[model samples]
Target: MATVRLLTMLPLWWSLCVSSALTPVRLRTLPLWWSLYISNALTPQALLAEWQAARIKSLDVDASRYHAQVLFVDDDNARARMAESCADALAHWADAGWWIYPHSCSLTEDQALIENPRQEAILTSLGFDGTRVTAAGAALAKEDLDAYDLVICADAAVRDAVLALGEESYETSVRLLADFATVADARSRALFDGLDVALAERARSRQDGGELVVEGADAQSDRDGFDALLESTLVLTAALVVFLKDSFDASFTDSFNGLLRTHFYDERHVDARWADAEPALRRHIVTGALDPRERERLFDAHMTGLRQRLSGDGVSS
Candidate 1:
């Protein structure tokens, strides 16, 4: 199916996570809130409410509304419980008639399923899950994120997993600065590192915010910031592809291109118009927790198209 996966990156250990480990960061919720607040677009709470509404709105009263199974990619047992509570917050979207599969990420074999062992400390310390919440039973599977219509992650961890699974440079999507305030040359570094220039300037513009005030980059606005994001992603992916193609031989090039087409071009199963079929970018920097089965399906379809093309078939443009 043409999937619109929106994942969260709550587990910072996955990649370039600057959000305080002490603070509870969620890809689908808090991190998005922070991104919007810093971007000067909406308050954290507003950002959350808006995205929830947009997602719900994406589905309607019609029983046939193509509901997206919202996935949450979190790890911390405490964080997982909190994310699930937001399930009630999902009443609106569910009433809209969409199916949501709340998901979280864990190592493929981490035997620790801490759903609510020590919730008070994590919950109180992070300021999330204001109401004490407990964890659910062991999740179906780490890779289950693919089973849904959409994936909502909570932090860079989730996004990194997406890039890693799809072979996308997932880290670049959320790599800003280790510490925005102390990073003496964040913008200069960004120029060299290929991070967003405007996002860098936003850091510079915030004179007193320091780490606390550095906004937007981490905030979540599932509706907006994605344009620049996808453009950045395409640039990076294209550059990587070109670099490999130039350095590698014809066989290697063919293999790599086949992979690219599978993820980006093959899937048109989403219930959106062509214009929205394959988004160039998205405002939300969500992640896909683990590789999805559709990953192979996409690549398989790509290979099929290539065969047809060689046979003097397949539509062009």
Candidate 2:
């Protein structure tokens, strides 16, 4: 009887599976309030792809509306590489069911794309079309300027150029990408570093000019679950230390202070999955505080598992 019931449902299950496989995943077209504008040099395709995938997966939302525009300041040889990287990365993500829309613009109308014959040839050999891969040396149209919720300059020069564009109001949102890209060579870290900035800002906005209040712990505690909660808290603390230190240049003391400040600590606003564990987690994080050297050691010990949990695939583009 069990076998007969299973056989009866087999065809229906197969049909449902086929329908799901054939359906296309639709992504958003407009910019979300959490958009990030990046400088041209930092627009590496692999890095952007990893960031895009991680952000959407971890947050459980379609982050397709977040715009990443590349603004070029000079015709430096390196700009060619940036152009190609951004184009390829955006193209790949678009194909992967992301509504990615990347635009490239120049600081000045007189300047065209970077002119490096050797680099152009190399880029072409690497499957980049010379014509399509070049940065467009044109002023940003009004629509482009309005698309992003925040603008991130990769360096001082990019910041200066953006200021010269006469978007004074947007200046409040302009931040140096370096401030977010603290990790020396890890692009995925840089990406999440930026997300930390965006999320913090978003949380602050929800306060309406006041600090968010965290509710007190419940009266009764689960003694049986205490051991499991403690273990999870330690792991999370280590992962956060790694993120802040490697990606934001935060010192041990500053990292702990910032972690405590994040809205995620607020029991009232935190996700339901973390509600019961937050108070214990906070206590554990505080108790395990260490110096920079010890912090690095803890990070190294748990970095692999942390990334796997936060990013699903551990930062692979």
Return the top candidate by TM-score: 2
Candidates in order, TM-scores: namely: 0.29, 0.32
Best by lDDT: 2
Query: What TM-score would candidate 2 get against the native?
Result: 0.32
For candidate 2, write residues 1-317 as lDDT tens digits. Answer: 00001112124665465345333331123243322332221234333334433432232111222223333222232332333243333234223112223334444444444344544444354444456555344544445445653343334555566766756665554443323212212322222222234432432232223221111111124322322221222222222223322322233345544543453323233222333534544564432435445544443434433444445644431
- lDDT at 38 for candidate 1? 49
Q: How accurate locally is residue 157 in candidate 1, as Cα lDDT from 0 to 100?
A: 56
lDDT of 2: 0.35
Residue-by-residue lDDT tens digits, candidate 1, 210-269? 222111121133213322322222222222222222222333334434444544443342
Model 2 spans with C-alpha error above 4 angstroms = 1-87, 90-99, 129-131, 141-143, 148-154, 172-180, 183-317
**Model 1: worst 10 consecutive residues (lDDT sum):** 210-219
Each prediction's whole-model lDDT (CA): 0.33, 0.35
